[model samples]
Target: MLDDEARRALSRWTVGEPNAIREYAHGAINQTWLIETARGSYAFRRCAQGGAEVVRQNHRLIGEAVARGVPTVAPVVVEDGNTVVVESGRVYALFPFAAGVQVDRDRLSNNDIQAMGRSLADVLEALRGCDRSLVKEGRYEVCVSEAIREIDRLLSVISELPPGEPSDENALERLTTRRAWLVEHGVEDGDPFADFDRQPIHGEFQDRNLFLGDGKVSCIIDWDNASWSPPEWEVAPFLDFVAAYDKVKVAAFLAGYRARCKLPDERLDACVWAYGLYRAHDLWLFREVYDRRNDKARRFLTPGRFKPHFERWLRR
Candidate 1:
């Protein structure tokens, strides 16, 4: 529930009389609310993670993409001609609610998968034309030493935990196994694809951010992670989605993407490798569970959550 002060602040926008405002629980980082008004329902979001500058940049890029025929919802301009309203150090913005369903990976048909791929390609192609000055350069470098040290630190923490749940035990096993894999594979530092050009991409392109309707992507939301990076970084999530390395589905997705833009097989392979290395070094889930004491992340602690994906990427 929003306090009267916050609600009054949001009223400055031209959205209309607010009939209802309810907290939206789906978002992990930003605080969101479904605001119902006489005109229409809107998604009111408080920029939680990034500051006002990021919110403004995202709005600019989203506006650019929408203008270029990308399927996405844009922020509504406020009374001050700005898309976002800064109230007491908090930034808030409203977007017309995008109505669609979020489909799981297994439930997606080949056509749906292909459409998903095509839609992503369309978004990338559209944003690629934007002046690079509008966005910040994205990071492509990988540091194995830091990851190794973090793994060791996590292992040390796990060692102190009193023997209890299977989750703790699983964490121990995963940490040790990942450390060994890092050494055996000789995971090195620095960006392998430094020679490639970087462009603006949807940083967190995944199932949750994508919405489906009528067997096609209705809207691609959450431009918060948008940045300038190698185009292949966006494609890595699809590799993880097509579990067990299902070549047919992979081929369908790639074909769909290729239909809209040029993604050579060699470049795609390199991107997947880069994504795999990222997964191997990623400790956010562990950090959330142990460091932040976030229990919600425990469900993803299953044994096959990461190893299978990493192994598949290796084979590719």
Candidate 2:
């Protein structure tokens, strides 16, 4: 997928000419490639948005994290002595190739799940004393109001689906059932945001972003979503995701997490409430928000892809 112009632009950051480039298959936000050169191999990332400044901030954050003993990938400074390089109207960054395997929640063993929790704690601890002001304010998570709007919009779309078709009929029934369940029980009893501890947390610490080497966490990648927020704001969704996949491993993860920080049951319950509402909102919007404009949205909207997850979340 590398055109001559793109290859030339990327060569600027390499030790020598780029001998080969292979695109990594599983990402939506950015295009990643394994770049090989006479000198060595590097991970090349082309960010589609946020420009150079965002990339620079990510570089700085990762650097700070690395210095604090957190396993992470910091960008390798290019020839210009900057972590980010502008090339052909796009922003690119080069990183040293970190060998590891990215395990999904379904495939995670008891030990792997526990390690994930500890690694997540490590990330939180490493970021504890840093200048919180340096991190961005707004989170990438869907806003409460936005989630409501998306749910309503998705319901409308479902209603418009042609009747009598087996697949559409089944989808309609499922959406209606989920919408009713969420409307009835998804709202939290009280606002957890009234007064809560806010700090810089890994905004998106999902399974795919975590890398494992041997038996321990080799590194955590994709710092693009780093932001300052209530710890519950991030942890709540994470717990739900982990629970959805494998509830048996939840205790191991919690044990690992508690080894570093205290997560009281009351506080975690409140976080779960908040996360439930957020997930309910994302259920409909995940597919409807972008329609066909975004490929991820389309894939999510396709029957059996995301609806099942939403259904499971609602059932809980």
Candidate 3:
């Protein structure tokens, strides 16, 4: 249920305010609405408190890229020349809906992986050229030492997981074995941050953020997690999805990435450990939440997703 006052304020704030019929696209920690206006169907997102800061950086990055002719969504500037407006204690901004196709599991490919790697490298390079202050830094750092600390957090969480929720027998063993192996072997020099290129990274540069059209990365969306971090961290997603089938695709992505940013072998090689534990914990976290819901996602509360995946990794 929305109101006229909210609509009028939004109209005064953005290009297509009045005739812009809006519908909820998502209503999570923040609110994202699809607004159809004379300007076109654009995305209007509202965030309060901490979200305001992130929206600022999101708009700044998009504006910077558009100004440089790099392909990205442009935030709509209001008649008052502000790209964002705060009204009734909420921060709101409108962005042109990014063009391209939604990526699906079946759409994964070596070419797509390589293209993803290349596009991230290109966008990072573009971001590096801007005034660094426009991008804000967060409290935590991504480093090998830091990664180990995060692993420790995951292990402690594992120890405290609800009694019946551990992985399936095979997956449980694989998780234990890999965790032990990583604890012993992964602490060496092969972290991606060693001599890494730094930037205002589109922090979550996974395939879901990629909008592909006609065989290229048409747009990267969802700046919710954008942060200033080593560009090498962008290597994780391409590695995670593709390494399930072709390790060579990860290799191709790295090769394409090197053409733009020269990363240390340590960081590139660390993709395996980084991606492995990342998926393990990420899947575990998803299960934790999904198990509490009534949706079909509850089917994943068991080891169905992890057993085969972990077994395959063990065979490799």
Candidate 4:
């Protein structure tokens, strides 16, 4: 959306003509753009229609993270130094361009992949230090309970999904059983361990949002989904790759994560099961909504191509 207003904002911030402008709204949520000014490139994000406070809190969190030595995009508050600027009824923030390469499966190495886990742990620890009281509370978009329930809903529709293979049916059944377990006995809040656990999160953590440079994680972009939530709850996305990549990669990730953040003994062993049923199921939903609909990758979703990769990822 490189309109006159956005260009004016860019000019006001950078104080120069933008050489180039790129729009990147690939995520299902929020609006994003990149502007290349004569001075430098800048990243821009406009909050979703219903999410003004979320972006405001995220701006506070970004500043807090910077103060704590964490890598993240800093929000450009309005002219008045407010975290968000409402223009034409849309909320937007401009940030200094981050330095790094977007991570992909092909570009990731054993160590490079493992580093992401460590980086996640660092983000968690730093987030803990931030004043959680400043973070707005209520209806966190990525809460575990709500996420698990959505997976259960997906499982209910699994069999009805165009009559796929028997294994697909079995996959849904296993996931459903797992969800039932969670609803029945898993921690439903009010535990000491749950202190920082259900605090805040980046919400969606994956290769897409991660960036690497100079042999280390330079920045973790896309703060629109950052919310108060659990710590390792951030790791679910990398664990989702089990359906497409080898277990060794997933292991490398967790090994790095454990080095920084340790899952409780009870949650550790079961976290792997989460490594399986619930997490796997949610990724499938993500794939249906994300990959299958992507204009560039739409053809990959034939009658039954992605399931085997999911199964194969699991066997490994």
By TM-score, how accurate is candidate 3?
0.67
Best-matching candidate per lDDT: 1
Candidate 2 achieves a global lDDT of: 0.69
Residue 38 CA displacement from its true place in model 1, Å = 1.8
Give the best candidate by TM-score. 1
Q: What is residue 103's positional error in candidate 3, in angstroms?
A: 2.7
What ranges in model 2 sit over 4 Å off?
139-148, 152-194, 243-245, 283-292, 301-316
When 1 and 4 are scored with TM-score, the better candidate is 1
Positional deviation of residue 228's Cα in model 3 after best superposition, in angstroms = 1.9
Where in model 1 is the C-alpha error above 4 Å?
3-9, 20-22, 158-170, 242-244, 292-298, 305-310, 314-316
Please rank every candidate by lDDT, starting with the best: 1, 2, 4, 3
Using lDDT as the measure, name the better of candidate 2 and candidate 3.
2
Ranking by TM-score: 1, 2, 4, 3
lDDT of 2 by residue, 1-316 (tens): 7876567767677578777889987776688988888988888888865888877877788888888888887788876689887777788888888768888777888888778878777788778877776578743243444544665776687577666645544445556665665555555434435456677777888777888887778888888877777766666656666655345666778887888788998876666655554555555334633354345333333354223343443355
Candidate lDDT values, in order: 0.79, 0.69, 0.60, 0.62
Model 4 whole-model lDDT (C-alpha atoms): 0.62
Worst 10-residue lDDT window for candidate 1 reads 302-311
Q: Each model's TM-score, in the order given?
A: 0.86, 0.81, 0.67, 0.69
Better of 2 and 4 by lDDT: 2
lDDT (tens digit, per residue) of candidate 3 on 88-182: 76777777788997666456777777777778788888777676666666323233454445545545555655666554333344445545555
lDDT of 1 at 166: 80
